[model samples]
Target: MSTARDYGLDEDYEWPRPQEGGWIADDLDELPHLPRRTELIDGSLVFASPQTRFHARTVGLLERALVEQAPDTREVYRNFTVTLNERNRPEPDVVVARAGADTGPKLTRLLPGDVVLAAEVVSEDSVDRDRETKPRKYAAAGIRHFWRVEENDGLPVVYVYELDPATKAYGPVGVFHNRLKLTVPFPIDIDLTAVDRRR
Candidate 1:
């Protein structure tokens, strides 16, 4: 059976790392060695195995493309943690945020509202959580944009999701191949086709 501890997850990693000895902050040094998995869902931890070669390629391509294409007003993060709530901190493969005013915390470790875009590259073990559960979770957390990178959907497969305030969740759908470009909430333009285009 898989366990949260097996993946080095705290019952509250999504709440921001708190003061040491504060119950949720125990064993800070051991966090890096824990197994990696989805930490956003309640009741159970989402078990994720290591990334496959194609998965790594997808994440790498997206990270590079976003870093190059995102406006200077935005910062992009790859494979880094971000808070979604009190108990969910699944690190999407990439995160894009508006440039901040030196708020001490780096742009990547954001509160629920700071994120403008989050992307997940599909790995066989995590496709469902990435394409389905995460979109709802990100919407519930008030994120504005989300993308799903399909490693198997032909040569240029990408799915983009947007939150529709009328529905209070991610609803607008975009499907494209080789590349899809989008204008973000205020100060950024994103092109995902360069990243998801694969053989």
Candidate 2:
């Protein structure tokens, strides 16, 4: 039988052929400079399509809103990786995590316990993953809260979810189209329409 090494398949390729099982998170890190963002889902490599200007703007707006409401002990990060497990390392569009004193130049990855909330701005190429696959993984990992942002009729819609410990699944809190008023992570208000106005 031909081994992966014998096929000259090293981890350096951006997107290698899917193996019999699938690729893991470590294989993703071995690739050279990636032209765009990528993720691993159930050991399968998923490369995100180029984001639209509106999409980028929505992420920035959401990040700023979350940061404004987050306490000093919690920090908001944009486009950072979260290691869900050996086979999944999703780079959520925005992540709210517990703040640590170590501000040194060392690298770090957020585990499930460290994450307070994980949010994804739905993209054209990532609809199913964002809506279905990611939520299942995040809930299984015990992340407290999750949010999905989508553009509808040229407007942003925010969907909120809270984990149900009994089921290891997320239960819908509410869906906000024009404005987001919430008190779970913290009391905050955001005008969802601003994402479209900026474009």
Candidate 3:
């Protein structure tokens, strides 16, 4: 006996029927009564599952670390969608973008060109998307940097990647555990173990 509110929707809400070619990226903004963190991938709506403690804390620590270390011309955001193209708009767990993309409160999404680095803290339900689909799409869209964070032994382990311009594919930068430090994407340093620390 689940009501619409149980799923974070209005009681009178009616789901949007699938279109022949799927939904365009712009349809996401026009859709009403969608759940939080709804993403459009290949013209289909993808709803986020409930957040886990591990996912929340890892994203929080990473966002905090990035915010503290990011340069004035860069900004950090969480759970916001990036418009990769007409048919794909996926939200990363954490995003670092050029300051110009922060168009104040009314902004709905970021253009691929505006993003500097995109990070995903892997969740059980998102392994396929994070590991296989997202990285490939992000690279194809010309994003320069990407990070995939996984929980191991209750700690964060980061795998970093840099895009190869000629190939338009990501090349492994490094795999970091315990601590994450980088210089290429604006000098980031984070204590991965802080996910367990009291905030």
Q: How many residue pairs clash in each candidate?
A: 3, 0, 1
Q: Residue-wise lDDT of candidate 2 within 1-199, one digit each (tens)?
A: 4233333445444345766788776666676544346677788766666678868989989998888888998989888777788899888899998897232233445777889899999998789989999999999999999999998887789899999999999999999989999988888799888875644
Q: Summarize candidate 1's per-residue lDDT along 44-104 as a digit string, tens digits.
A: 3444776776677777877777787777788888775556655566678888876772322
Model 2 vs. true fold: TM: 0.84
Q: Of the pair 1 and 2, which is ahead by TM-score?
A: 2
Specify the highest-TM-score model's number. 3
Give the residue spans of candidate 2 off by over 4 A.
1-20, 101-108, 197-199
Worst 10 residues of 2 by lDDT: 1-10
- lDDT per model vs. reference: 0.64, 0.81, 0.89
Question: Model 2, 22: alpha-carbon shift in Å?
Answer: 3.0
**Winner on TM-score (1 vs 3):** 3
